[model samples]
Target chain A: MTERMQNAADAGPGPHYLALRDHLAGEIAQGALAVGARLPSERQLQLGSGAARGTVREALFQLEAEGLIYRRDRSGWYVSPPPVVYDPTRWAGFMAYVAEQGRVPTTETLGKQSVAASAADAAVFGCAIGTPLFALDRRRAIDGRPVLVERILVDPVIAPDLLDEGLDGSLTAVLTGRYGVRVVRNHVEMRPCALIKDVARALGVASGTPGLLVVRRSFDAGDRIIEYDHEYWRHDAIRVLVEVRTRD
Target chain B: MTERMQNAADAGPGPHYLALRDHLAGEIAQGALAVGARLPSERQLQLGSGAARGTVREALFQLEAEGLIYRRDRSGWYVSPPPVVYDPTRWAGFMAYVAEQGRVPTTETLGKQSVAASAADAAVFGCAIGTPLFALDRRRAIDGRPVLVERILVDPVIAPDLLDEGLDGSLTAVLTGRYGVRVVRNHVEMRPCALIKDVARALGVASGTPGLLVVRRSFDAGDRIIEYDHEYWRHDAIRVLVEVRTRD
Candidate 1:
């Protein structure tokens, strides 16, 4: 090794906080910082990078906020486990997804009842204003982390009184059990949206936090936009996958 | 409006800076803040919101950085137009995209080319490691705003001289120009991704910026993964829409 290389190695780093962040990033890229790797404490980073205590802590906070790392109070920070790449092609439902991951799934229905549709809501739902529709506001959490907030609009003609039933657990299950409505296919549109009003409060992020706006319409055996819903998801909490194929 | 509503509206907001941001956000939501609307100067905002000059400037910087606003040197900040929603499923080729929008399309190669496939990449392209390939990195801007950075891994067996032509313009056009290879269909997977360093820099965002990871496997008339390309796009720069029907 060159004398300069040796000296540089012995000296640890050139810039304190930047150097520590760089090392961690490199480790993550090389899989050295494997998914769920428990990162060293702030004190350890201070020692490792020869930086001030405040600098080390700031770097850690930035990474955690970005979803690259997480903290557990006395337990300190740890590498955030990568989000499971959810393939839309698989067409899995909420219940199936949670079961596969072996996580206890819970739903808190903020409100589940018929509401008069607004003009914008009516147009999207293909109905007129004052049309009684089942509107559900659901907050979904996995392992106690708020992952997504969804507002689902269901057509009443297809599944009557869906709103009246006290919804629990899976959304798909409610449709199937109450009205025998099955989702044979679905179409989705993905867009970028800033959180508004209730969605922001539910996700525990500041109002106007950037989020993924996923507009999905479920179809039955016949083609129709029966269930149109809007999902505002925590960006780090979910990853969507799509597959494209060649046409003959 | 009720007197209570008027008081709520006129009350001195807790934070002057936040109130300004909220006002702009409300205007945008109401369609009153049209795209390219020039915002008031920092002094004007400070006077209007009862905030410090530093606080007002900070807010403008944040808005400009987020693509919600931009500065034209001495001209000050203005609202940016909403980004185009790009549907990879509806069409094929970058050239076609511009043409479809009635915009002029162009290309400019930015970096060197190479050939060597990783195990994962090999599987995606149905090729072997060390397969003759053209690795091209391209930065594409629509109407002068840098929107996407694409890294294309092309199978040289199909078009050996792909490297000879810099991937500045339409890749699909180049493939067709050289080898009768046309992208008749594409399988696209859309997922949320934090940007990599190089891609983030090219897209004018901070490292690990939240963007879209769209992996498209292009195919000709015959079913084949002709080329496997990874496209990184700014979240607001594009949207993905898919239309589906029940399988008979």
Candidate 2:
């Protein structure tokens, strides 16, 4: 442990916890700790580093903050995979993109229900208040780790009996194949957010965990709103990419 | 306090801490607590709610996670302002967008240096390794609160005296006016990140604070990479909006 501390000191100068953090971060960056690899227990780390429990925990927390690792409730810590790159302008659905990125993707339907659109919903959907909408809640996982929870509100007028369809597949594919409704445009808004209780529970994280909130309004050929979606993603799970080309 | 708890209970069924969180969230949502308003001290909140100290803190942590409030070290909590809407596809610079949203914006140049590009920088710039470059670091604030820190690297060959110019203003304006270099296109990538020690100190937040990282490569009329920027934003500071329309 003293020799390891000496190596950490050579890496940089800081508090004891910071040295520990630097050492661990170096190991992760160098792939000594592979992605999805479970970390040693905190007790083990404390014993190995000769640091107090609180110091060891603080170092681990720093690594977590840096998106190098994550914790599951009662399951222990694991190295986080590289974030999936997401281009919002692309039309490829979630399943296709995740698969293209060489990761296994799966979705589970958490809930489905009929809902009455509120005034805010009416404004966004360009429909009258009280309009019936199909609401679907789903949890998506990459490599068997839950990363995002999404709620989709569909205008029942566009896709009748949508709730009866199998929802584990891509909703976009379903809309295009069944209803001939193609999303030609999207208005997306993303921000940093903290997970609420229900969403946190769905993603298997704490309620106050920092997250990324992405809201999308999808439109069809005639520019009519087809679906509105709210996605709550684990903060470390994805990276958004965008490209803008100048018009000639 | 009991009456407040009763009101919270009416809102939802949850633990005492959750009820308290709900009650405060309701107030913020209803505008009873305005943006940028300082929250009551924890002691005051404890006295007012008649909740235990830990319970009060737990509720506050929940609210913080919800992006309703934020804490400054050694300072009490404050109501987080509505995030400034950021459209990466738009050509307008940060100052313009921030002012358009009715908020004050300010920038300060933190450091400037002349450097030799590394292999990674060389690849990004399409220049040879050890090519001379100018690096600039700046901090941007909204309504007197530091919200982002940005590091920009410029191909010095394009603008020989880049480091000598006043950097407190928009670099886009400077590039266009001084070098006749207009940024006609941009490739942007964004992800959730944790602030490292130096950046966190500049933003007055704890090291490893959750943040958003946005990296942009700006191109000129010839499609040459003119500038590369890495921006670290407070996670709660901005919301990104993008509009994508399919070609007819």
Top model number, DockQ: 2
Clashing pairs in 2: none
lDDT (C-alpha) at residue A131 in model 2: 77
* lDDT tens per residue, model 2, B1-248: 12222223244455778777877887887999889888889999899999999899988976776567888887889889888899887777889999999999999998887766755688898888777788888899999999998888898888889899999988988898999998889999998776655678888876655688889999987889988988889887888998888876
For model 2, the stretches where C-alpha displacement exceeds 4 angstroms are A1-31, A39-63, A72-77, A115-119, A126-132, A221-223, B1-26, B41-59, B115-119, B126-132, B221-223
- Candidate 1: DockQ? 0.26
The prediction achieving the highest TM-score against the true structure is: 2
Window of ten residues with lowest summed lDDT in model 2 chain B: B1-10
Model 1 chain A, poorest ten-residue lDDT window?
A1-10
Instruction: Give the per-residue lDDT of model 2 (tens digit) for A1-248.
Output: 12222223244455778888888887888999999899999999999999999899878876786677899788899899988888988877789999999999999998787776755677888888777778888889999989898878899988998999999989988999999998889999998776656677778876656678889999987989988988889988999999987775
Per-prediction DockQ:
0.26, 0.40
Each prediction's TM-score versus the true structure: 0.71, 0.83
Per-model root-mean-square deviation over C-alphas: 7.1, 5.4
